[model samples]
Target: MSQPSPQPDRAAGHNPRSSGPGRLIIALYAVFVVGSLSRAGFQIATRFQEAPLAYTLSALAGVIYVVAAISLALPGPRAWWVSLAAISTELVGVLAVGLWSTLDPAAFPDATVWSGFGRGYLYIPLVLPVVGLWWLWSTRPGTVQD
Candidate 1:
């Protein structure tokens, strides 16, 4: 029996982009992707008519989470841009939905991932974008990444 030896990183002086906080951020995004997808899938399957807006928004959020997670996991400039775009959109969605939910509670009728800034998810949705952005900026600059 034998184990594979460690391979050298492509970057000469750069650390792995998915190291440290990036790992945490990626893990969180993965959890949200699963959670939002499950919730939206169930709602859409059994009770979409009850709250189409909320359910659809949940599904959209899940897609965004999946994109962000994948972008962060990959190593390239395209992935970087995709990650930024996804996270930025997520921030906007959370803020808009949170404000709307506050101003017009009846409008929601049911909770989405971004409702009340993700209150049901312990407000991680509200903070994730900022953390993700920071991780992106802190990582080394290049086409190959993560």
Candidate 2:
């Protein structure tokens, strides 16, 4: 009697995308989302009048981080696109805010998430997006060899 053929192994099992270092990246992004969203919400609700621009930027950063975390957790072309968009936005925000604050410190009398290149957040804001892009590129479909 012929034996039944074994089932094909799923790519998910060894998907280097969300395994190993990728998992740590996702966790870090998630933590940032929580912290940023909470801080932004509190600042906007209670002290938006104090610094509208700073509060708005904080809100935007929180949203970008949320998107980044979600996209990193999922595996697909759409997720990859979302990750790229979010990370790109993050990089832009950090650079723009960093430059604007440096040139005219008075513009940001109050600190935003991207202020001083995330000096308030240990500069993770500056480095996280670059690392995120690297993760996405390394884990592109069929790019990770067994």
RMSD of each: 5.7, 3.3
For model 2, residues 34-146, the per-residue Cα lDDT tens digits are 98889989999998999999989998999999999888877666777888899999999999998898888898979988999999999999999889889888887656654
TM-score per candidate, in order? 0.86, 0.88
Model 2 misplacement above 4 A:
1-15
User: For model 2, what is the C-alpha lDDT against the true structure?
Assistant: 0.86
Candidate 1 at residue 17, lDDT?
54
TM-score of model number 2: 0.88
* Candidate number achieving the greatest TM-score relative to the actual structure: 2
Score each candidate by Cα lDDT: 0.86, 0.86
Residue 71: error of model 2 in Å? Answer: 0.5
**Model 2 Cα shift for residue 129 (angstroms):** 0.6
Instruction: For candidate 2, list the clashing residue pairs, or say none.
Output: none
Residue 104, candidate 1: C-alpha displacement in angstroms: 0.8
* Candidate 1 wrongly placed segments (more than 4 Å): 1-15, 140-146
Indicate the residue-level lDDT of 19 in model 2: 81
